[model samples]
Target chain A: MPTRTPMEVSIAVAKAVQQADVDVIAAYPITPQTHIVEHLSELVANGELQAHFMNVESEHSAISAMVGAAAAGASTFTATSSQGLALMHEILFIAASLRLPIVMVVANRALSGPISIWNDHSDIMAERDIGWIQVFCETGQEAYDAILHAFRVVRDPNVVLPMVVNIDGFNLTHVIEPIYLFEQEELGDYLPEHRQSLKLDIDHPITMGPVGIPEVYTEAKKQVEDALINSKQVILAAWQEFGRRFGRAYAPIETYRVEDAQILLMTMGVISRTAMGAVDRLRDAGKPVGLIRCRLWRPFPLPEFREAVRQASIIAVIDRHISLGAHSGPVGQEVRSALYTLPNRPQVFDFVLGLGGRDVTVHDFLEIVELAEQYATQGPPESEYTLIGLREV
Target chain B: MAEKVEKRAIIGWRNLALGCAILEPGSSMHLLTGTWRLQRPVVDPEKCNQCGLCHIYCPDLAMTKTAAGTYEPDLNYCKGCGICAEECPKDAITLVEEKE
Candidate 1:
């Protein structure tokens, strides 16, 4: 049995990579995500983990190097956040389209205009359509386990796609929590040696990423889209196998006390923990309320999400990022679209909050629930989304 | 005919992503680019000294040595770049307008 140790999530992530025994790590230091690659560098330096740790100049070079490493048949990994992730935007698509099974941990942070290094989903949300398997972690333990699972999921032959595991910046990344650390032997049983049949080898001499002219561009895109959409099965299989092996189960949409509830609060990342507290208070006060934490953000888990909120009449979606000028927040828009065709769908109220590391307390969640209830009865407010907890000058 | 071959190339694969990738290096040789030429280079055998200067300077690798030890330009793959004609010391190659 693996021993439970209290440590920072960043350390746990590095330890998971160590256990997986990745072949290459190309990373540049970025705030919140720095500790993960720093610890990884230490592990490599100490000879505890046998991997090539390339300290690159920038995040773009880091990701570009990983693309080359992955193409060369190496199990590659990297970590970045915020501006770093933005810098790697162009290469992110190429990595996915080439079907490189590289795993990345993105410490989700707000994109800067005012230059705030804080926790939010804007960073990863801006990259939602980059064609990688994206998963969000709500706790330190999830962050640890998800990294291991990401390797297994991405390396699956049926789903040869890159994966991004999003951990809220400074919230889960810097927090210390008790997590079960897996033994290297046990990890060997779960994740085997990565052997890609199609790779850049001198003996085979293959050319990857060729020009797709007008006659072939659509088919190439369809191939990538189909691979991403079809990867959901492999994702679920990996989670199930992990549960059976490690005794901790995970789901795409994890619900908390949703049975017979009239109103549900949907959230992602660490805010879901706070929302659970609000649900407890609302439940104790004789109000039937529930919470649903969205774990898998990409390949968007449509069927599971629709079923999770099917019984609720009103759903308050707490978005940590704003999709300016859109009808609602990113998650809100996705949820509404998923449930649009249902005969008796719930009314979704978009509440944008906690941008730039603003605190979202139980009181705020309670207010959001009340406002959502009002919107349900009053047929929505004038605006598509309401910005909560904003101070008026 | 090149368009037909390109269409066949696009549809002949089971997996488009893997198929779109050129698994064999230098496979672009299979793609006939000769039709891209508006003017073709004609070798002047009478004026040609077997110096192989045009063969050495052909950008497309279209010029080849024949069994008689004379250099000839393979028009099937040549793009009519006129580099060989311009570089031939013996004036052994000339570019003529290709007509339908």
Candidate 2:
């Protein structure tokens, strides 16, 4: 049996990577994400983990080094947030297109302009189309378990694409939580050795990342798209196997009290815990309300998402970042797009909140539910999305 | 050489499953670049002192050393970059424009 211990979320993440026995860890330190790589470097220094710990100068070099290491048949892992992730944007696409099974943990943080080191979806949301399988975790345990599950999904022979496990910046990474840590012996049977047939070797030299002219560029992109879309199967299989082994079941769309509700408040990350409280309060008051937390972000889980919201009369999507001038927030736009074809689709109200680590309380969620009800009765909001809990100008 | 052509066809994206972008190791050898040349490098055997400068400088690894120690360019895979001709210590290599 795995031991349940109290540890900081960042420490738990590092321990999970250690158990995964990654061959290389190349990362640059950035706020919120610093503790993850710091613990990993300490593990390498203490010889607790037998791996190459590269203290690269910049995020670009960190990702670049991981790309080379992964290409050379190494089970590679890296952690970054905000600007660090933005710095690696160019290489992130290459890592996916090359089909390198590199796993990354993004301590989701707000992007800079005013220079704030706080939690937000701006970081990962910007890189959504980079073609990596993205999963958001609501807690430290999910973050740790997702790391192990990410490797299994990415390195599968049928699905050799990169993956990113996103955890809210200071909210989850800096918090201490009781998590069940898997022993290496137990994980051995669950996750076998990483085997890649297309690795680089001197004896069998191969040219990778060759120049693709106009003739083959579109086809190359199509191949990558198809691979990313098809990886959903492997992801589902890995999660199912993980549940069977650990007895903690997870799904792409995790619901809370949505069985018989007319109003559904949808959210991602740690904020869902708060939303659940609001749902309980509303239910106690004889209001039909529930919650839907999105776990899978990439390949969108369209069918699962459509089914989750099919019965609700109104859905209030709480977004951590805005899409500027779009009809709704990023998540809201995606939800609306998924339900566009349905004959009797529920009205989705976009609620933008929690930018730059702003505290979102259960009371705030209750207010959002009220606003969503008003919108459903009348028409939708006049603007694209309502900025919730904004200070008076 | 013919086997490489067949291997390229087998490994092409059209034949592989969607999103499988990996190529076989040393697959570049199968990509014949000789036809890409506007000018071909010809070596003057008498001027060649067997210094192997052409072999050391060829960008495509097209130059091969013979049993007798003379460096020869494999025109089939050579793009005729003229790097070997420019770097030749004995001026043994000259680039000749191909006839249209």
Candidate 3:
């Protein structure tokens, strides 16, 4: 039996990584993401977790160290935030292309301009094409569970790619919630030992990440692309098994009150909980409003998403990050593309809100639904994407 | 490694190994980069003096120290960068343009 304990989400994430029995953890301290590695360092020092906790100088070296450790047949882990994640941009592609299953947790935060240490999806949105398996978490329990699931999925023989479990920086990482902690013994056959077949060994020499000249570069890239695309089934299977063992099921696209609904609000990360509340209030007021929370960000989960919003007349995609000149937010852009070929597709109205830790109340969600409905009937808005609550100076 | 096959016969993306990692050890020896060389290093054993500087300075590990205290350059693997010729005190090694 697992013990339910109230703990900060970051510490719970660290505990989950500890429970995964990671061999190497390389990280640089950054706001919101620091507590996770800080706790892991303490655990290692107190003999609670037996692992090499390296306090690297920068996020670039942190990820680089993880790459070396992972390729050398170690279950490696790391965590970072906005600027740290940006610094790791160059090696991020290298980690994915080299097929190293180095699991990471990104405390999603806003990018620097005015320099804010607040929460948003801007950090990870910049890394949309990094080729790693990326997932968003709604709560502390989900973030904890995701860390465990990430190690299992990435280390799988077929899907030996790196993974990132994104928990909204201050929103999710700094919050305290009741998370059920599991014992390593009870994990039993669920997460088996990570044995990388093609690892660097002195006895058995094998060259990894060798130069792929023009003759082989395309093929090598195609392999990574195919691997990510093919990992959908593997991801689903892992989720199903996790549900069967833990009794809490997770899906790529989680829907709320979508039955016979005309308006659907789509969201990701912790804000989905607030969206659900708005959905409930709207339902109580005799409105046909529904909510869709996208748990799986990368690999898109296009078929599942289409099925989720097929019945709705309008989809108001709420994004924490704006794509600047692209007019629509990143999620909104993807939703439009995914629904482009569908028959009688729903109209997608993108709303970029809650940037730099700006508060988004349920009232804001209600307003968004109204705006989306208005746009649906009155053609499109002046701007394809509406920046909600921007005070006009 | 498996009988120098034609480039056209290279395996497709589906058949390529994971991450395109070379699973076979010492597989690079089959590439024979010596074909890329424009000049070849020639050693005059008479002035060689058994200094072994060529063996130390050769970037490609192409120079072998003979049992008779002289160094010989293996033209099959050497790219003829002339590093060995430049470093040799006796100047016994010289870079000559390859004929065909």
Candidate 4:
């Protein structure tokens, strides 16, 4: 139809979530991501949407409100950015293990020391292991599609896990692109009604958050793990169904021009588009190169990753968040672990780049490839973490 | 008077959709055999200061204090979610599964 802006994408997301019948809205406002909450607030204020808008005092409370609502048998949604997301750390893990299907939109922004209001994965990175079904979006349409599929994944009978659909803070959150909007009737047909056994009830109340001992403690964690691991099948089925309706399919790891590549570039977030451009340039010049976009970050599709990297000899992983003095960057460490556990693995390496939305140009992409080619023959460097996009002293 | 609706997903409709309800509606024992017998929160009278962390954190609000300053749990309301035992700063509570 017509062109759309990042704000339009978020509006579409809110509307679609509304169409999907989200019963509760909990969120805090911050730059870059501020438009999402601001617009959603207008919809609620104008009586365009019917849901409890928990204008929580903090990101922590925003998350907690959703947690409470989800337990109350409401399909809940929330949004946040940067340090606001960091505030929700404690409850994010709780939401996943408790198996309450709360869907959230995180306008990915950088954590501050220097006060950045730009696009970066630092916000989502800090929460890598919080056990939510994480989806990274490259475009506005992807952002809209991710929210719909996330609802299906998060609420699946087997995979009652919360989900976070993240788009790069200002880059995607503030930018504009046309979205393939869904009709309310079609959205309802695709997403079923909120259906969880009333985990909360006043008449016959049951405890929501409880303490566990050694005996049941392991089982609690085990149940979550089993649910998360088992969710793989259900997640794929939902995505397939989503594609059937939305006309776009998202894989855990999507490949670009890697059929017979000499080097592979692995990354996430909006930067993948730039890396793909590098892939094309390298390919045109007869330098076999491919790029893999990690769309699903948590409950990492290990099998698919293992399969994707099996053919490549040298792989370079670019991380948007740093572990700080750690062996590898967050996503890099995850990639290494996944590949190491696989029977057929590649010589995977990683670098920390674009923290606080630092610009990572095509030249930087070449530097990553140079390192990958070096590792292809010499093996992984002695030290794991390499800081890229930093000016040498 | 409270009205109730059957939880279709929790009690899967596939079987019902296939025209097999064994009994129409209330003919079967839906009150699960041992759900009530499992892990009741036991309070340690000697250690309990009755600070009420247990009462507040209990998801179901199963704990309440009497006018005499003694805390007690309403077994009818406590599904043994264990938040009480876990949140009790003094380790004043324990949960053990019971048969009766």
Candidate 5:
């Protein structure tokens, strides 16, 4: 029987990793992500988990070390937050391109300029094209489940791409929730004994990441791109199987109360729950508003997104990070691009809010919905995005 | 034991080893660096000393000691860097511009 325990999300994440029986974990601690690696180290020290827990010098070294470990056919894992993820930026591409199935859990946080250690999507937004399978979790339970599903999808024979499980820093990462932690035997055959087909073997004597001279550079990249797109099948299958066994269903796009709603509010990460509450209140108030949460970010899940917004006439896209010079936020930009080809696409209203861990409540989401409806009459704003909670001088 | 590895041509991306990893060692030998040479080194066996300085100084290991104890460069793999000519104690090697 699975044990449901009320534990800190980070600790629960560590327990999930322990359950997966990861062979190596090389991580550098950063706030919001510290508890995760910290508990993993404790598990290793206490003889609870038989794995090599490496306290790496930096996130760069952490990811680099994972690449080496994964290439050596060892199941590897690592966790990091904002600046740490940014530090691993260079090696991130290398890990994905080299096709090492190293799983990483990113406690989503704001990137620094004024040096804030708070929650936001800036760090991951900066790495939108890293070619890794990226997913966002709305709750601690989802975050914990995502870790197990990540190992299954990435280590699959046809999908040997690295994966990133993004959980909102401080919001979801530091929260204490009742999570159903499964025993190893309960996960029977979910993740089999990992044996990577292509790995660094002294007996075989093969080189990895060899110079892809001009002759095969494009094709080499094409291969990884195809692998990432193709991996969606395995990702969905893992989620389906997990739900069948564990009873918590997940999808690329999760919808709530869109039956006859004419307006939809789209969100990602922890804010989705607040948006769901806002949808409930709005429905009670006779406003035809619904909610759509993007659970999968990479490979973009175009078909599901389009189908989710099929009946809605307008969509209010909530983005946590401003794309600097771009007219809209990164998530908003992607939504617009994805919906551009449709003859009857929904009018997407973009909002930039909750940066550097500012409090976002159901009230804030309600106002966003009102503003989206208000702007729908005006046929797109001149500024393209409404910056929520920005104080005026 | 080190196995005998042969040089092979690059394959298409579909057939390329995972991540384009080179499975065959010593594949660099097929590159033919001799065509990169702007000048060629010629050895004069008559410079009189059998000192092996030139053999030690050739960066590419292109110089080989003949049975007579004189070093001769295999131009097929030599890029004519002239390090052997400069290091020869008796000036037994000369650099000559390659013929067009």
Candidate 6:
């Protein structure tokens, strides 16, 4: 809303980062993510944001710089896209293990052998288990808002871990929408201004990053699990607080009109907007269909997901990334895994819809709903993974 | 008769030296003399497996050898960080706690 330009969404987030009073940032420019940190760098250079914005040599070093900065007890941030995020893979795990609570924005883009600089969820899918709360946004507004939510989530005592906000590289990151620029004072109330809980103290010089022996190794991993498990609650609390302060609502798994619906459609990232439109059409035509838009991915919201789709006869998931030779697509696989143990679990199916920035119109989503209807009457298996929109090339 | 209370203290090892299990005086004093005590690793040929893992992993070549090729821990100058013992695959050299 600041300016009509789609790039302003990223700028809004930059302002939020400025307002958040980040102490350090290490960024390397790549498409879709370039404008974000570019504005961030300008903010730092213009004396608007008093922070060390280190322009690193590689994305690897960019994350490495933030890691070192965060470990030394500074609120750190970085933004990157497909190849850049891929390059920072090894250091990503290190950032989480060190409990740095760094925030990053991944302009959700497809990975390459063909080298397409387009939007998809592949890049994030590659690093899902690197121990970060991954949030996907459907609009530029959500993208900006999720940045604040990410900071709150990562910095919370229950979840002292790094977080990534995946905005659709071309769709959400490059789309203009009315995003309310949050006031710093309001943000202070919603998102607490607690600095690092613990950091490098020279008086008590303890060796951080020490090699863990077998005796302490499992305990170290167990601590991370406990913190991450508690993150689900912290994530919801962050969203609720965001809603309270800003009058904008969010959920880990946001359901659209599923109270008495028989069939449900599932989606994530920017595609959920298109899917929601399709669900509205289906509902008007007397099809008992609804939408489940997963706003949060990591520390996957299992209980909420089961409750959202409990009464629904079928749950058709639209995945933007393909996990080749696997059970199904990434989001599709996880959705099933979450609901499989339930006594009255819905018959879940996969619809591997879009990739490399494929345009998934509302009609494509309608096709998914229709397919779910057919499978519902036929009494489908425990679950099935069926890609909806791929003609064998 | 009151039980005689002896005001004496003795520190000793709980494990015996079996085969090549040498628990030389005391080792693993990382908290105390890590910066002061120096003990380079020495390997007894009768027990070593010539694993070469220790040679490769030693950050400081404090884990070196004598002229005849049996590994000797140079204690006079070694920082006694015990990185060598931590890396030794064969577990041949037991660090004698060089008193600080």
Q: Which regions of candidate 4 are displaced past 4 Å?
A: A1-7, A342-344, A378-382, B1-100
* Model 4: DockQ vs. true structure: 0.04
Which CAPRI category fits model 4? Answer: incorrect
Error of 5 at A379 (Å): 3.1
- In order, what are the TM-scores of chain A for the candidates? 0.98, 0.98, 0.98, 0.94, 0.99, 0.94
Q: Whose DockQ is higher: candidate 1's or candidate 6's?
A: 1
Which stretches of model 1 miss by more than 4 angstroms? A1-3, B1-8, B17-19, B32-100
Angstrom error of the Cα, residue A48, model 2: value is 0.6
Of the two candidates 1 and 5, the one with more favorable TM-score, higher being better, is: 1
lDDT of 3 by residue, B31-67 (tens): 5566678888888889988878788778888999877
Residue-by-residue lDDT tens digits, candidate 5, A1-393: 567799999999999899889999998989989999999999999999999999888999999999999999999999999999999999999898899999999999999987989999999999999999999999999999999999999889999999999999999999999998887788899986788998988999888887766657887888889899999999999999989987899999999999888999999999999889999999999999999999999978999999999999989999999899999999999999999999999899999999999999998999998889889886667899999999999
Candidate whose lDDT is highest: 3
Clashing pairs in 5: none
Q: Estimate how well candidate 2 is docked, as a DockQ score.
A: 0.19
Candidate 3 lDDT at A321 equals 95
Model 6 alpha-carbon drift over 4 Å, by segment: A1-7, A378-384, B1-100
Candidate 2 residue B65 C-alpha distance from true site, Å: 20
TM-score of every prediction relative to native: 0.89, 0.84, 0.87, 0.78, 0.88, 0.79
TM for candidate 5 is 0.88
The Cα error of candidate 2 at residue B97, in Å, is: 18
Put down candidate 6 lDDT per residue, B19-95, tens digits, no spaces. Answer: 11122322222222223665545566777766666666665554566566666654433676677677776677676
Q: What would the DockQ be for model 3?
A: 0.59
> At residue A39, what lDDT does model 4 achieve?
72
- Per-model C-alpha lDDT, please? 0.89, 0.88, 0.91, 0.76, 0.90, 0.76
Tens-place lDDT per residue, model 2, A1-393, is 667799999999999999888999998989999999999999999999999999899999999999999999999999999999999999999999888999999999999876879999999999989989999999889999999999888878877889999999999999999999887877766786899978788886666787665546777787788888989988888889999988888899999999888999999999999999999999999999999999999979999998898899999999999787677789988998899988999998899999988898999999999999988888777886899998897
Enumerate the candidates' DockQ scores in order.
Answer: 0.38, 0.19, 0.59, 0.04, 0.55, 0.05
Instruction: Give the best candidate by TM-score.
Output: 1
Q: Which ten residues in a row have the lowest lDDT in candidate 1 chain A?
A: A212-221
